[model samples]
Target chain A: MSAPIIAIDAMGGDYGPHCIVPACISFLAEHPSLQLVLVGQAPLLEDLIARSSIPALDRQRLHIHHASEVVAMDDRPSQALRGKPDSSMRIALELVRDGKAQACVSAGNTGALMALSRYLLKTLPGIDRPAMVTAVPTQTGSCHLLDLGANVDCSAEHLYQFAIMGAVAAEALGKVRPRVALLNVGTEDIKGNQQVKLAANLLQAASGVNFIGYIEGDGLYRGLADVVVCDGFVGNILLKSSEGLAAMISARLEALFASSLPARAVGLVAMPLLRRLRTELTPAQHNGASFLGLQGIVVKSHGSAGEEGFRSALRRAMIEVRENLPQRLHGRLEHLL
Target chain B: MSAPIIAIDAMGGDYGPHCIVPACISFLAEHPSLQLVLVGQAPLLEDLIARSSIPALDRQRLHIHHASEVVAMDDRPSQALRGKPDSSMRIALELVRDGKAQACVSAGNTGALMALSRYLLKTLPGIDRPAMVTAVPTQTGSCHLLDLGANVDCSAEHLYQFAIMGAVAAEALGKVRPRVALLNVGTEDIKGNQQVKLAANLLQAASGVNFIGYIEGDGLYRGLADVVVCDGFVGNILLKSSEGLAAMISARLEALFASSLPARAVGLVAMPLLRRLRTELTPAQHNGASFLGLQGIVVKSHGSAGEEGFRSALRRAMIEVRENLPQRLHGRLEHLL
Candidate 1:
């Protein structure tokens, strides 16, 4: 009858505890069956929480664990692994590893997080690498896209493993019998390189995956499949390109509205519609990138996430913990592999 | 001096001459000196042109060069090359090969076009493989993105060639000393695969290229650099994913606006702004994908492009011919390599 505890790296984001503490307080208010362990510099987090309007009952559920070091945004992954042993990001993952928390969430350097999590908790059985999976907003719903910069030069075997993990993760996230597709330039059988062709054959022959041949980049956002799989290089590029295009469009819209009085008036009238569009497309709404295939559940918040975005990541971690995502993925992968 | 004659693959796209003939007529009306050789089944093109509003003066500049066959969208590239010798796509390129036309434009199968063009016009000296370059709409203007799906498995040398050609193409397209950046997962020098890293080194050392370090996908539409370079696989995925995401967002906006009467009223008031946004972001506005590093100008339009989109491709080919893009690329690449 004990509530699940989630560990938060309070000093990991750009604004550190200022963003994380408020987010944790907000998250705690909503989830009654959850407790939080804030991992960071105790004094700084304490100061932040004191300034915030957290209720006494919610405050009682919040615990702070001190860590001396912090991972810099520009720190090399290898350097962070070797140097920052007492870092907030490392401490949060350690809580998950030691069973002190059901899940761990951090708004830290993505490369550092991946390296340290793999080094600490290690990959699940039959998994050589832990691919990063995130929910990309699509037409029908969101599609689970994997290898968003884990293994850049992935082999056919690596892609096959990703397909297995992605399928399990998608199914665990409530997609029944997730339709999986390999990402390529074209949807044809002979579109990409030798590796992709080999991966396609392996995926087609593999058990437990609803392999739907090849899907192109444009098809990915159309919600053509539940799971869109690719090597980290291509996946990362696709994800980032989408982000860049979205940002550019947003900037253009702002300029257009500011250009003339008529445009500004129309924008004001369409403010509610515009807000919905912004909320629906913004990356912050889908903030967490799950480090799938790890032995324990660890979610990565964007390093520059604000309060609401960090809360979105924390909420994602709670959902993963409730679903027992890592366990589900491990079980499915074992049978499938 | 005679007007530059351009070859057109009239029976190549989804609607074949129905799309191509109308586009040709519109383009001729704009540029009086421009001549077009419509290569396809002469009867189909003639019938379509006869039905179109082609004035007697403009009709004199239009000529239909007959071809016996059409290249199917799904035809295997190699099979199409050998089997469809008298194909419309082939005859159009042959006009350029024989120096009868200054450039060739097609809204046909991409792989077939690339294969036959490589076999016919050949690559510029020192360029191993031709890259498909296209102008992606950005905030400032448009960025020339290359290797958009010509070579799937690109080595460091291949990428280096692409970078050089892309830079040259950008400069020829009016960008002053085009700032070229290698597209990768992150902006860091050590972010991508071995090939990308090696290409980065090669680009940095090469002369005549304003080699900026690395740019992530999100930077592409920001106009951070005039030319963004990547292997064809990554480039193609980025291009298509952007297209897919843009389309999805447009559809979502329409649905949101049409959801309620109030929202529809706001949409009606904001129709002009929405129209402006659509004109700015739609793929149809940036329809042509230029085949760079070839010995002559060859532009590929979308297979299902409408009359306006096909006209965009023809205009692009004309621009390349006027800029002498291929010769400029050849000269620059020879020195850079």
Candidate 2:
């Protein structure tokens, strides 16, 4: 098989090429049949590439495409699209759209990435807007949740599309018949708002999707269903809140261990297991969130991610590229429609 | 101030009188000026009460008011109201309404409790609906989050009322000029749906409220604001999801500590600190969730709570009763309107 080329928005995240270049080096070294085009300012990319310890042959597989501008983390999607036509994020997505790369990964402004991706790649037929889908860790395993801040005021039809798209992504990537659920306050049919209630009915009626009634926030982490669907507003809040709670608990645990001499000793002995536990639950393990229902694959990395996190995101993009996830989603959605 | 009398729904929760009676016994012993009325089926409660070793004097402080029926956890609000007219949950609220009790505590079906309480006591003047308000632990301290599972699809006015009610509750109970914020996906004015954005404008323009801008779910636990307002749909999902995530992490931590002999040895030494941590963060420590904007105070405990959890809920009701929270809210809300 020919080597698959992936485009990376090199000057996107908080540390720009500093984070992206090293991650690419590690990824390229691991995957022999992979090529990466780092899209950013040529001078900075060259500087980062020179400093990065990429193996000679792997280095030969790395390419640089200069994009004059970088989208700031806080830039509005409209502003980023209008003012920075040559942005690294836009250029990287453009490469995926033009099939120069199978997929694109960006750690830039989320709003801009979603907007530019939709504008460039367009939504798949019968899809209104692309939903942000991410794999979240649960008790049994990980489950995919969609619309994690893409379209805030989603209609019932929008949610129905999210379920179809989420189920499609789960089946393609997770390799399981996706059990879809609407995220609600209560599991009862009488619970939640009109939109969710309507969405639930649509999901239940839809063929080929395993619509498993309703799931609450707690149920989302319990691995109750394969795909939990919601509007971007609720999904975004749920994702962020889970993150905040995790960080708080971790910080509290650290403080507890550091508070006393005996605790310190316990911490010393338990350090290895604790480290393993942290790695298992940390956000880095699930860094890339896919813009599902798009015409081409686009993965968004957390902007503040370090090398490990960025690499995780790039790896996710690579898997989607290998799976031809966007095309798979198209087929599944077509059959469902 | 006179000794406050709290009416408890002894036949409401999963364990019914077994959990409620013991909690009331402990609560009465702790507070010399406290009185309790355990409302439930007389024979069953009498059997449990008779079996328990209660100090004679404290026993006199507790009273059992008989009710014929119970509200099952799964019963619909409307169904419970129609079919179980003489339910323990209803009788307990009626005691508060009849001026025989200062406050009511229920571990009943939340929907039933909210519906019956609204029907009996009615919302405060200028209030449209009563919101479920609770204090959630954060990095700095606990913050009051409102409409936790009450009105699912909240309009701009409904959210505005929640802000007023939450702020008033915080001031009356939390003893601070609450820093109120509209819960949204993003903190920016341009973010979130039209309802939240409109609520933001209303909150900002309102009088006697410390209207902080938008707060994400993560910020809810960061103690960034004293009162976070959202539609019950989002609020309930957030609350339940947080609970689920906390439980998952705690379970994982336990597994981590018990995985090997060395880990177990470390766990033995860290047991005391871990116990302290658990006590501080457990749901039992913060069991009561208030029904705000109502004419009378009502605290809803977790339906499956044990003795300690039930006691926490009763204690919260006592504190709210002592503060004359409902009356204070009525006065404060008058000016806001």
Candidate 3:
């Protein structure tokens, strides 16, 4: 296979290029056949690259694509679309659309990224709208949760589409015959809102997918299903709430560790294992969310993602590129929807 | 002042009277001025109570109000309401309705309990529906979250009422002019669905509530607001998902502790503090959820809650009864709505 080139929105996220540049150098060193087109201001990108200890050979593979504007974190999706044509986020996505890169990765405004990607690449066949899907850590492994905030108001058909796209994305990420379940308040058939109930009905009769019954939010962490689907409104809240709870627990543990001398000794011995466990389940590790059902690949890093997390988003984009996730989703929709 | 009498659904939860009977005995012993009516099948409840070591004085405070039927976990709300008129849950609510008891507490089917509560007690004036409200531990203290699963499809008006009711409940629980906020995907005024945005407008103009702007799920755990309001669908999933994540984290920590001798030694020393933290944050400690906006106090215990959890539910009822929460909500609605 030919070397793959991935587009990066270096000016995105809270930290911007200072976080993205080092991640690019490290990631480029690891993947010998990979190239990155870092999209941002030329002078700033060049200055950061100059200060980095990147090898001469790896530097040859790293390129800078200048974009004039940067999307603010709070930019409205509509405003970001119509107003900022030369934005780093928009240009990175444009790179993928123009076939300059196989995939686009950004730790930018999610609404802006989604809006720009859909406007640039459009949706695949049999897909109503692209959905945001990300893996959340569970006991057995991690499960993919979709519509993480892309579509706040979704219909039954939209949910059914999310399930189908989620299953394809899960399989592409290496789960075989993934069990797909609708996220609901209760597991019973009679539970959930009209959208979920109707979506469940559609999923039950669909082909080319393993449709499990409704799984409650508790079941999500129990690893009861490989792919859990919900409307973006609910899914967004679920993901954020988990992050909040994790932060609270970590803070409490830290406070407890600092309370006394013997407690400090125990905390010192115990924290490594706890921290490792946290990286496995919490937002710090599972960093990227894919905008599934788009005509091309787009991975969204958490807006506050660090260097390692931005690289994780890059890794996700590379995997989806190699897997040709959009094509796989397109094929599955032909049979399932 | 007269002693407060509470009606209990003795055969409600998974363990039935085994869990309730002990909790009842312990609670009765603690409150010398309190009385309890344990409603269930006469023989089973009687047998369980007899097996327990109860003081003669405390036993006099406990009475058996036998009801032939039990509301099973899987029973539909409508079916439980219509077919199980003689159920322990139903009779317990009836006791509160007839003013024979100051409040009612149950660990029965939530749907059935909500249905029964609404039917028996009715909603407070100006309140269209009753909502389930629970206190979740936050970094600062604990915040009240409402509409756990009663009204899945809530309108802007319903959410406005929830805010009024939530504020009243928070104040009744002791917070002075408790800050109320609508739970949404983003905190921006332009963000979230029609209901939340519209509800925000209503809350912004409304009196008697210290209405804060929109709060995201992460803000929930940060103790940013005293009361967070959402539709039942979202609230149910949020609470259950939090439980699931806590369980997952605890399990991972336990596995790490058991992996080696050195780890086990550290675990033993660390576990006491960890367990205390878990109890503070997890459902294991916060056991009861109040059915807010009802004309009378009806605290719903977790069906799987243990002896201590049931007792926590009982204590919640005691506090609500002392405060006369329903009357406070009624008065608040008159001023605000």
**In TM-score terms, which candidate is top?**
3
Least well predicted 10-residue stretch by lDDT in candidate 3 chain A: A277-286
Model 2 regions more than 4 Å off: A282-285, B275-285
Off by over 4 Å in 1: B282-285
Which one is best on lDDT? 3
Q: Give one digit per residue, the lDDT tens place, for model 1 in A169-200.
A: 88878899999999988887778898889999
Clashing pairs in 2: A217-B241, A218-B241
DockQ each candidate and list the results.
0.80, 0.77, 0.86
The lDDT values for all models are: 0.86, 0.86, 0.89
- Ten-residue stretch with the least lDDT total in model 2 chain A: A277-286
Q: Model 3 clash pairs?
A: none
Tally clashes: model 1: 0
Q: For residues A66-172, write the lDDT of model 3, one tens digit per residue.
A: 99999999999998899998999999999999999999999989889998998999999888889998899998888999889889899999999999989888998
Worst 10 residues of 1 chain B by lDDT: B277-286
Tell me model 1's lDDT, rounded to 2 decimals.
Answer: 0.86
TM-score of each: 0.97, 0.97, 0.98
lDDT for B81 in candidate 1 is 91
